[model samples]
Target: MRIGIADTTFARYDMGAAAIDELKKNASDLKIIRRTVPGVKDLPVASKKLIEEEGCEIVMALGMPGPMEKDKMCAHEASTGLIRAQLMTNTHILEVFVHEDEEEDPKELKKLADNRAREHAQNLIKMMFHPRLMEKEAGKGMREGKEDVGPL
Candidate 1:
């Protein structure tokens, strides 16, 4: 399985470019997928450019959670817009994290997170199937025969 991580983890650890180098070394077989930093508010324009320039196979945008009472509505609107724009580029997914606040009930928060994930998936499917965004490149690669592998 390919392992991937969001850029937030890198920023959190203050590892900067060193983290990307480490991931590349340890998980050479895994694809390095780029994701925006949470709470940054602005879309990660520079990060996206770097990911594309570096030839990372996948990218995702991080969407913020709404305030306590308006979590669902805020997430829906923010995520929908982010996903739409990210899809225009090479990003295949958007990662949304549940807010970790002491005031909210854990069970209720989990439920809301699950619902948001499902909604995001549905939106992605709808966008990917649109005529302009069709996965023709993916289909072409599948049509070409795969190379035979010798004994592992």
Candidate 2:
């Protein structure tokens, strides 16, 4: 299967690279198409193009929104666009966004980005090849980059 990786230039960390590494480690039969855009707002079009034009069955949209009000707003807008793109194309585009304000330390931020991207890559694998595996984890409070909260 073909998988698309769409990332942003404004991102401080290379989450796409992390996702690619994880994907390669777990799945050997996937063809990955990478598309880099200027910022988070541009990811939707890039993902859509990857799906419709490049024949990707699924896409991973990785972005890092800065620590600011405007950045969060932009992230929301980009998310909306991603949802619209997914509905229009009938394909899955996994949105992996790590807001800069999530962690105060840069090291932690990078770790969070990498872990989240890798985890989402695994999620993509489950979506494509093992949907039942994901279903089995429902309400388990699983998380990436940090400890899982577990079920309540």
Per-model C-alpha lDDT, please?
Answer: 0.41, 0.97
**Candidate 2 TM-score versus the reference:** 0.98
| Candidate 2: 10-residue stretch with minimal lDDT | 143-152
Residue-level lDDT of model 2, residues 23-85, one tens digit each, is: 999998999999999999999999999999999999999999999999999999999999999
RMSD of 2: 0.7
**Collision pairs in model 1:** none
Score candidate 1 by TM-score against the native: 0.37
* Candidate 2 residue runs with Cα over 4 Å from true position: none
| Alpha-carbon RMSD of each model | 12.6, 0.7
After superposition, the stretches of candidate 1 with alpha carbons farther than 4 Å from their true spots are 1-28, 31-40, 43-47, 62-77, 99-152
Provide backbone clash counts, one per model: 0, 0
